[model samples]
Target: KAAGSALMKNEKLVEDIIKSVVNAVNIPVTLKMRTGWNEENKNAPTIAKIAEDNGIKMLAIHGRTRAQKYNGDAEYDTVKKIKGIVSIPVVANGDITSAEKAKKVLDYTGADAVMLGRATQGNPWLVGQINNYITTGKTSKAPSLDKKISLILKHILQIHDFYGHKMGTQLSRKHIFWYSMHLDQEKGSDFWPNINRVSNHSEQYLKFHDFLYSI
Candidate 1:
């Protein structure tokens, strides 16, 4: 719904819809959005005000314009600006790949929170690490090689069970690759192609287990 607003080019309709959705549901309504449709059209502050006025409980702004997608550095100037405009809890999101970066984002934007997207794909522990570091100024210990392998093994089996054998393996492939990427950084991404070749679930599990532990 957020992405659709840029294409529709009508924040008013989006606002109306947001109002309707908020009025219709008992739960609080929240919003997530990029800076705007393009660099010149950074209307985040305007949108933030609209959302707040219409009873949005919280707002999450990705620090990039829609045109940039994942390219370029995320621009937090708008997030900082929006934080000043809206009274609701504001979340700043973009390029937060480490604990210090998350802290910097929160401090710079004066946002209520910092959000992570792609950074937590395989290293889900990062969420806790960043939080603990930010709150306590103590870095959470990264999992050792042995602990990482155990986590990876458990993750794949859970994925396999949730989606079942057929769809689960298909879904698990990309995640398996992500976990592999970090674990085998010394070996390089050549490891991914090897994982892609294993089609069977048991075979894939064994491959992930062996490959991750070997690292």
Candidate 2:
């Protein structure tokens, strides 16, 4: 079973697994987990202590129960409670889409850091923006249309090289779809379907190049 299942609610099983993993690993071990199995069974604080006791060097908590999955707002109260009880570094995660939100979550939970997930899918520059805000108290400017197009092209070519033509061309479609959503909405909707149909890397590349430049 996944760790997010009943294992989260079973403190003994949680501790035993952590102990075994820590004892077996020569390198430092870190754990990433949701708050708990469900709202009523939230046992993250108990698990956090168990992790720290069993030699976990760091913990990253996504502030939602496994039942909640990707729905609803992430609550930081549980994360703050976990941080207070555990000496290990705690990373706050989930719903952290912007620099301001990252700062807010860190300040609220007193976590050592924040982790960004789905939000960075099409907007990788968000990492730099967040870093700039955290370090300099200034937000980085959004990338220009040309810059976005350049990155999309570069990213697509790299994907092609890494995965080879057949699989690379298949994998690149999702990225193209994501990048398109960040651009012209109407055009992107129209363009993605056609791009999705292209089977070859060269054709996919040319279509993306023409569509982006045309916009």
Candidate 3:
């Protein structure tokens, strides 16, 4: 019905869409897809071939079916299969939360790279850590508590400046929640509840500043 995995149900349609997009674009075309619509219909292999044949330059596959959504563990056997069947560069995505996990996914799936998503929500340094571990075999130290607080406050300020106070205050809540996940739980519990109620940028900023320093 929609324009995503639902389209995967019809192979001819998938091919037509891919060909159309590839022909319409001057830039290299890429595809990001799930394994399939459900457990019984994992057509990623078939779709991957269709995409490559239609001139898709690269692929990134999240190792879960559309039905599975974000609920269970992500499987890589399908991704491994896709990599083996396709000559184009493939990047593996899903549940790559740590540097070791990133390397393991790449090694296991033979993917060209691993994409980080939810794990990087508040921890931007995770990318550097993964790169360092992949290239140097060393884990980068986590930022100090003070450093985390500074970054969180700076991020909130930037959001406020960019989107103005109303929308920025609303948007900053999720980032704050994610960043707080790395901090003391008791303090986070208190801070989040209080911050969630604040509707103004200045008050939100002041409360966050006070909360972070209070830790």
Candidates 1 and 2 compared by TM-score, better number: 1
In order, the Cα lDDT scores of the candidates are 0.85, 0.89, 0.90
TM-score list, all predictions: 0.92, 0.92, 0.91
Q: Which stretches of candidate 1 lie over 4 Å from their true place?
A: 1-8, 186-188
Expressed as tens digits, the lDDT of each residue in 1-215 for candidate 3 is: 66787877888988988899999989999999999999999999999999999999999999999999799999999999999999999989999999999999988999999988899987888998999999999999878888878888989999999998999999998988777765766778767888898998899899878877888
Best of the two (1, 2) by lDDT: 2
Model 2 worst lDDT window (10 residues): 1-10
Give per-residue CA lDDT, model 2, range 16-107, as digits (tens).
88899999989999988889989889888888988898899999999999899789999999999998998889999999999999988988
* Off by more than 4 A, model 2: 3-6
lDDT of 1 by residue, 122-187 (tens): 788899999999999988888787887788789899988999988888999989877877666655
Best by TM-score: 1
